[model samples]
Target: MSTILFDKIIFGPVHSRRLGVSLGVNLLPTDGKLCSFNCIYCECGLNEERRTRSKLPTRVEVKEALVQKLAYMQSEGIAPDVITFAGNGEPTMHPEFGGIIDDTINTRNQFFPQAKIAVLSNSTMLHKEEVFQALNKIEDNILKLDSVLDSRIRQLNAPNSSSFNFDSLLKQLCRFNGKLIIQTMFLRGEINGEHIDNTSESEIKGWVNALKQIRPKQVMIYTIDRETPVKNLKKVSGEDLEIIAEVARKEGFDVTVSA
Candidate 1:
């Protein structure tokens, strides 16, 4: 079974395929996962295997740890391209999420004001006014939307709610007014004998139309780059990702391909 990948609240000035030289801030416990979706292609492992460890960190803990880390990096003369909010679970799930973002911005301004603040949100919390406000304050606000079709979303993300409103979520994303970056994962896979592939022509056709509605500033098309919980899954090729990116580009949207 795949276990937790991020073992600390603040981790790495590591290289990122999309966002360069990132320092990750994990709001959830390093040893466990707390997420709204149980995606088969998740690098942190399946939800069941992920919840057996540490508790979520408090807002103060996050602020203190982030500040300490930033200070250390400053002393070491290490410059990060971005301070990324990503880890084993959703960053917006934290109780004082808006407050946390504010603290992070303050710290970033003090230490690495040149660096960008980025959030890898699942878009589940966009319904919350505070969550939306916090995300809007950042430029690299990456949001996930694997598919526009509800059936495909269920198969791909396995969201916590069976009542996941497809239209409502899309509308919320549209509210970003093309300011958000759309992150789409393209893959072909089988789980428990069910074959699923979001790279199909029909799916892409609908997805392109959906992009037209959301009017994202950029669409990040990527395939699985790490081991996933589901062994049957396969990553879409770089060439294929560019093909999908081209479709979105033709629709008048800038895109980044990370295959």
Candidate 2:
């Protein structure tokens, strides 16, 4: 089992393929996970023991810890590309998510002003006014929309019962008129002996329509690079990812392929 959960405040300046040298801030509990969606490809695995409420670090604790860590890093000549809000579960689910974002921005600026603030959101909380406002403050609001089709989304993401609308979610995403990066995980496999590829004609068409509607600044099409909780899941090849990128490019969207 992976013992990477953070019970405290700060955890790595881990090497990330997309966001290099990121200092992770896991607002979720260190003991277990908390999230709105139980994504099939989530590195944290399914939220088996679901909690009715989110277990997260207090806003003051997070602010103090981050400020201390960042100041130490700066003094030691350590520089991170970004301070990321990512961990065992969804960061936005924390009740003080908006305040935390504000604290991170203020604290990070005092220490590492050059480093950017980024949040890797599952997009489930976009409907919340506070969540939207907090995300808007970040430098790179990287949101996830694995598949636009309801069936494919249900198959791939397995979102909680509360978050079931794929169309409405895309419409809400369009409201973010900032440096938005939409991430799509391309995978091909059989879940319970059923096909789960989102690149099919029908699925891709749904995605394209959503992309046209959202009009994100960039589209990041990438495949699994880490160990997934699901054993039957298959990783899409780099060539296939590039092909998808080509389609998105032709459709007039700035796209990048990272496989």
Candidate 3:
């Protein structure tokens, strides 16, 4: 099984396909994976394959790192478009996620006031009051909603929870009330002898209805951009993405397509 890890508390000034030049903050373990879902197309690879022994950064450590990194960037006259929360796993899984976001906001204000704070979550932890409140405070609160069908969601995200269902997740996501960005990963693949393709007509139709009900401020559709754990997976073409974008547009949502 193939797997990858961030190996750092704070990493990157890398170009984000959707968010532009952004800095990454990893609140999960620096050396291992700790996510609620084991996505087949995750660029970081399989969850069970994670092998790093590093631990999650403390709130203070994260705060200090942000201050130092931001201070240096400011001193050098460099500015990042966004400070994104994503790494090896679920950032909201961190015990002090709320406090860390608070620290990050303060540090960003002190050093890079122009930068926006963004968090990319799997949407599973929104049930936690602290996670919901913290996400509500951020400029970009991106939540993953990979498919509309519960069966498809099970095959795609491979949620750790046995009770994870599409309807319940959609209801939880609706709590954001159009304030969130819905991120969908488009791809075709198979796992455990089951052929999976979330870009199909039925899948797209289901996704459209879900987006309408959620009333997300924006929708992000993207395909696998890096080596995935499941090598059988196929990336959806750019032309095909435009076709999907039209469906989202007709559904009355701003769309961003990343091929």
Q: What is the TM-score of each candidate against the true structure?
A: 0.97, 0.94, 0.97
Error of 1 at 5 (Å): 2.6
How do the residues 1-259 of candidate 3 rate in per-residue lDDT, one tens digit apiece? 4556677788889999999989999988876788999888877877888755777789999988888888888998889999999999889999999999998888888888889999999999989999999999989999999998888888889999999888789999999899999999988867788888888888898889888889999999999888888778888899999999998898788999999
Q: What is the lDDT of residue 136 in candidate 3?
A: 92
All candidates' lDDT scores?
Answer: 0.89, 0.84, 0.89
lDDT of 1 by residue, 1-259 (tens): 5654788889998999999999999998777788989888888887888774677888899999999999999999999999999998788988889999999999999999999999998888898999999999997999998988898888889999787757988999999888999998899988888988998889899889988899988888999888888798898999988888888788788999997
* Model 3 residue 198 distance off true place after TM-score fit, in angstroms: 0.7
| Total clashes for model 2 | 0
RMSD in Å for all candidates: 1.1, 2.0, 1.1
Ranked by TM-score, the better of candidates 1 and 2 is 1
Model 1 CA deviation exceeding 4 Å by range: none
User: Model 1: which ten-residue window has the lowest total lDDT?
Assistant: 46-55
Tell me the lDDT of model 2 at 110.
Answer: 92
